[model samples]
Every structure is written in C-alpha cells, then in structure tokens.
Target: MVHHTMATSTTRASKASSKINPMNLRLLRFLSTALIVGTLVACSTTPLPPASPPPASSTPPAVGAVPGDTAPLPPPLAQAKSRWVPVRWAELPGFSTDALHEAWNAWVKGCERPAPAFAPLCGEVRRLSIASPEEQRAWMVSRMQPYRIESLDGNAEGLLTGYYEPLMDAARVPGNGFNVPLYRTPAGLGERKPWYTRQQIDTLPEAQAALQGRAIAWLRDPVDALVLHIQGSGRLRVTEPDGSQRLVRVAFAGTNDHPYQSVGRWLLDQGLVRDATWPGIKAWIAANPQRVNELLWSNPRYVFFREEPLDGLDAAFGPRGAQGVALTPGRSIAVDRQSIPYGTPVWLASAGPTAQLGRLVMAQDTGSAIVGAVRADYFTGWGPEAGDVAGRLKQGLRLWALWPRQP
Candidate 1:
C-alpha cells in the first residue's frame, strides 16, 4: 500500500549517528534585551536581496564554526535558497506560551554538531537545559534574532508534511506468514546505476539469486515492506531462530538508484481511487486482490537497509536525521537546506486536519520532496500513532529562522 509522507517518496539512504556534547556551567549571562532590540532595529532597516539558488548537488554543507575570538559577531548572511528579513520577537505567534524547555532538548541535541553560527552558544544552551520556560524564552530573546523566511518572490506560506519511523514485527528467518524479505544492499549494487526495478526484484531469478542469504529479517506483509521502504527507517521486533526476541533498527543503507515515484500520486492520476492515503490504498487492494502486483509495481524505486541494534538510550530517540543527530520526536524537522541549513533552529507554525503546530524545531533533516522556502517535514516520532499522523498530515506552513544575535 502507498503511504503518504514527505519521506515516503523522497527519503534517500542515510546512516544514523548520535552525540551530545558535555556541559559547562560557567558561561556568561544573557545579553541585554534592550541591546538586542536596538540591533534588530538596525538590521531591519532594509530586507536583504534575494540570494542565488542553492546548489543542485546532494552533498550537504560542511560543519563549521565561528572563530573563538573576542570580536563582535558578524552580520548574518542570506541562505543559498532563501532571504532573511529580521523581525521582532512579538512577530512570532504563540512564542510566549510555548514550553521552550521542550525545544531545549532538541537544541542540546543539535549542539552535538553546532553550526558555525550556533557554535558559540552551545555552552549556554547546555546549561539552560534544566532552566524554566521563562528563562529559556528570555535567553532566546536576548541572544537570538528571528528572521521571517521567504522565497525569492517574498512568499511566506508553503507546505507542511509529516514523517515518522515505522515500527513492525519481523522474523529472524522466514516462517508461518513471514515470507516477505527485507534484504541488505546486494552485491555489485554500484555496478548498475539504476538497479533492478521492484517487479524485477520480485520476479527475476538472477535478481533473487543475488539477494539470497542477504535477508536480515522477514516480514509478514508485503505492504509493510513497502511501508518500511517508503519511510526509509524502522524499528523491528525480531523473534530469532533461538526463540529470543530483540528490538532493532533498520536504517537506510542504499537504494536501487531509481527515482522515487509516488504510488499515491499514481493512484490518484489513474482515477483508481478517490483517497490515496495508505488506508484507502489498502482498501482498494483488499477488494481487488488480483491487482496487488499492479499497484505495487506502479513505482519502480526500491530501498535497501542495514540493521542496527536498539539499546536502552537508543530507544528514546528517532533515527538520526541528515544532521547526524537522533531526532527529537516533536522537535525535529526535515527542511530544504537551500532555505534552512541543517542544525538551525526554526520556528514552525501550522494548523490543519492532522495537527496544529506552533513551536520550535531543529532543521535536522532534509527530503527530496521537501523543497521550497517555508516548507518543512515534521518528524512525528515512531510507532502506530506517529504513523497515523505522518500518513495524514499535509497543511500550510510558515517559518522563522531563529538565528544567533551579536553579543
């Protein structure tokens, strides 16, 4: 069945990494609010000119930091894909009411690989983890500037979608009803640019031969296999041959190099269904079971995976995003790097069918479909409830980049 999420059709293979730097409590106090107000006034005198479009390359920008010097901070520069217009703290909706301490967790996680602009603030960010929402808000107002993100044409509204890591059951070896396989990257995957299509992998003897003995786990549902492939990562409860059960994560290892084609979109275009969400697609499949293969083969793209053990601490976080940090359930977002760089803190707001969101989120990941200024993919975390939200969320969005202020 076709699931709907920005990650469903757009996620690329990425390994997971997690780190949180140690804390030091002796950092200086907050900058004066009056000084920050004055600086904002000066910076807001004129809107920055539009920046050149972001590079087309898939490689992410290098991690960097400002020099550890006593000099005043430099003026903020425009992003490769969006312009920044400085705004007052009052411009952010629901800013005062948000439980900023919740966002602080994500902030500290991001500090594990602080961006050049945010590097200097990591110590203070760490120290404030246990601070009150009032203190966090005060520090944010005193130390950072909020810039309303806009496209080259000055549009502030864009799309908001949601994604989550799926959770499912698996067998260490194919059994009773667990016949579908999740294989590791097959040998010589690099030899062919666009590897065997989904249909080929399912039917071609040579393709199956290459993947033999490569199955890390077997799942019960082919639809579930598609779900795992679409989401790019998942948690599997595997029952081993020895009758031991363990939890594990299967992260994105590689793909068949085929371009992702959304089966939901295909179904919509074919007029085979009115609602193209996962449930609707499944309904159609259940009614016309004979056409299951036809629906599955609509998009040829296939993803491969690598299994990672899920330890005690690992269970608390989602898979590592593009920023190389484990995503905080409600506080991490996948954004187009052209508009918002990875590791930047973003103020996100949206209200629609699936959710009403107004809070701070770290720009920790990016998806191919999550393009354009003011766009975002909210990480709803893992499991069934998160999956329900991800499959249904598609709404309007507005963004403000919370950038570092000059000391």
Candidate 2:
C-alpha cells in the first residue's frame, strides 16, 4: 500500500519551470496516517490539549458503561459514513480542462499491470497515446463511466493530503556525527507477533541484539531517521566507510506490527507545539532535545528498510507503488483499497489552505488512513521542495472513479 503523511502548511503555486529529471533523483518516503478533520485542524492550528477524559462522576452510568464507569465510548462521526454514487462525466468539476496526456503517462504505467477488468483495454489505451486530447476524452467517454464517490449518508467531501520521499545525508560507519542506525528487518521476524515497539527497539537489549550487524546506514539526526521510518522509504546520500559517496534508497521491508500512533496527536494532546507539521514538530524537538526520547516513544510503530540501488531508470521513477508500477509524480494517489481498486482512474478536485487541484489521478496505491470512498493521498514525489508541498497539503476533496463500462 502507498501510505501518505499529512502536511499542515498552505499550498503555494508551483513554478512552471519545475520538472522531474531522471538523472537528478531525490529520495521519497511513503508514510500513511489515519487523520480525520479534527486531527487535520489540530495539526494546522495552535496546539491544544485534548478535552480531558471525563472526571470520575458519582452519578449512575449511561449506555455502554458499567454502573460506576465514567469513561465514554467515542462519539459517532459528524459526517456521514462513506459510500459511492453513480454520476455523469459532465458532473465532474474539471473533467475536460485537464491535460489528459499528462495523466495518460500514469495510465500507461498502470497498463503494465492492469486489473483484470481493464486488461483488455490496455491496447486501445496505448494506441490512443498519439490521439488528441479530444480523442482521448471521446474514447474515455465511450468506454468508461464516472461514479461520484460519497459517504454512506451522502457526504461528498473528504480530506486530501500528500506524501513524498525525503532525502538526507548518512554514513556507512557509526561515527562523525552519524550516530543513529537505520536497520534492516531482523531474521525470524515472522515468528514474532507485533515485534518490538519503537521504545523497546531503542532501549531493550534483546531488541538491540536482533538488529546487530544490520545497520543499513547511520544518520545524523534521530528525527530525520524517525521521519524516514514514518514515510516507509527514503533516499540516503551515504558516505561509505571507504570515503566514497553514493545515493541509495531504503525501501520499506517490514514493520514491528505495532499500531501507529500519531506523534502530532500526542503533541496536541500534551499541548506542546502549536503546529504539528514536520517543521513545527522539528522546532519543538530542537527546543527540547532532552525530551526527544519521550517524543520518539510516543509512537510505537517501527519500520524496517532494505537498501535499493538508485541508478539508471530507477532514478527517474518512484518506488513501485501498491499497483506494482513506478509512480508518476503528481499523478499517483493512494486510496482505500476497499473504496477504489488499484489501477482505477480517478478525477480529483480539492480546494483548501493548500493550493487548488483538479485533475486526473490514478489509484496506484493504498494507505492505512485512506479509508472512506472519497479519501485520497496524493503523491508529491521527492526532494526538499516536494517535502515542502507534502507537509502542507490538507484540503477538502471530491473524487470520481472512471471505471470501464460492463460489456
């Protein structure tokens, strides 16, 4: 699954000159978080302590509680549950205006491993590459149906976020300020149920013993390393023990199987930082270095990685997504597998603190947080600029899945 991390900054207009260069590759990490409107709003605003859990009450208990119990069940969502509704292409907000040719690149990638339903249409999809936008639109119109996704109670809007690969400096040996080690998945991981939590991995001797001789690379900043863990992948500019430098990707290998707890949510609950974006989180860490371990242990989930060479064509494309295709920057989205099947084409529209976006995106990935029918996690690609955009993009979204018509 393609997981995405949430961003809190407002989106800025992208420069027209910005383009992806295969030779100049950047590392990206795909991390997914299950964020709701409350979390999104909390991340972007001043940090406030979560409402106190109800104080002990002397009164009798309400439904779902024992006679003396005061803890309450969480309230139901304010928005309706998720569902899908059929709609016409004409109803799509920016259907005709999008540059389908650009999206066609993503479609072609998906065709490499098309779903069973779409397998037969791959040839026609390829042949139409040379066709005009109007022709492509016509072909889609003729063969596909657009379904407007909604919540069970018919709420059409949902949250939109983004994630990207992060690039950082590293070393082969643990010295010269590169102290934190990124580990490969340990042997016999299969035998363990929900391996060590981040705290145990960091502090326990047995947990540390399993990782001995398994350091993939050593990093300077523990927070940077944690960011890599959260994203599930990252590019490291490694200074080898022999004094040579090379770029390599640390792709997701395995995890500790612990449930992911949002550190942002932890900070919000603690009333520490006002903004929980990476920048804000980093700021809090810098000012309170002593509390670093305390903060790191807040999230129990731990991710392991395997080194992958970033050379040739691999440098140009992203890590293979859940669809088994190299993700097209800005064109790939991670959705809930249950809501939108992999390889489906979708029209995405959103406007919020982040920039406005309306275009064609392929459902080449899935995320833990992308649960509802209308939810999506847009891929922002790699490098610092992509990270900037990824960290800030939280918006209201609408989606229409374009599915092949039944024969």
Judging by TM-score against the true structure, name the best candidate. 1
Residues 22-110, model 1: lDDT tens digits = 11111011123324543211001111112233333211122222122223434545887888888666666567666666567788889
Q: Residue-pair clashes per candidate, as listed?
A: 1, 11
1-407 per-residue lDDT for model 2 (tens digits): 33435323311101111244211222221111212211111011111112223323211122121122122222222223345566556666556666676677688889999998899999998777656767777788778766777777677778778877777889999998999999999998879988989999999999999999999999998888878876667778888888877778888888888877777777877989778877788788889999999988988888889999876446555667889887777788888877778898988877654555667889998666667867788777777766776777776778877777765
Lowest summed lDDT over 10 consecutive residues: which window, candidate 1?
40-49
Of the candidates shown, which would achieve the greatest lDDT relative to the real structure? Answer: 1
Worst 10 residues of 2 by lDDT: 40-49
Which residue segments of model 1 deviate by more than 4 Å?
Answer: 1-77
After TM-score superposition, what is the CA distance of residue 357 in candidate 1 from its true location, in Å? 1.5
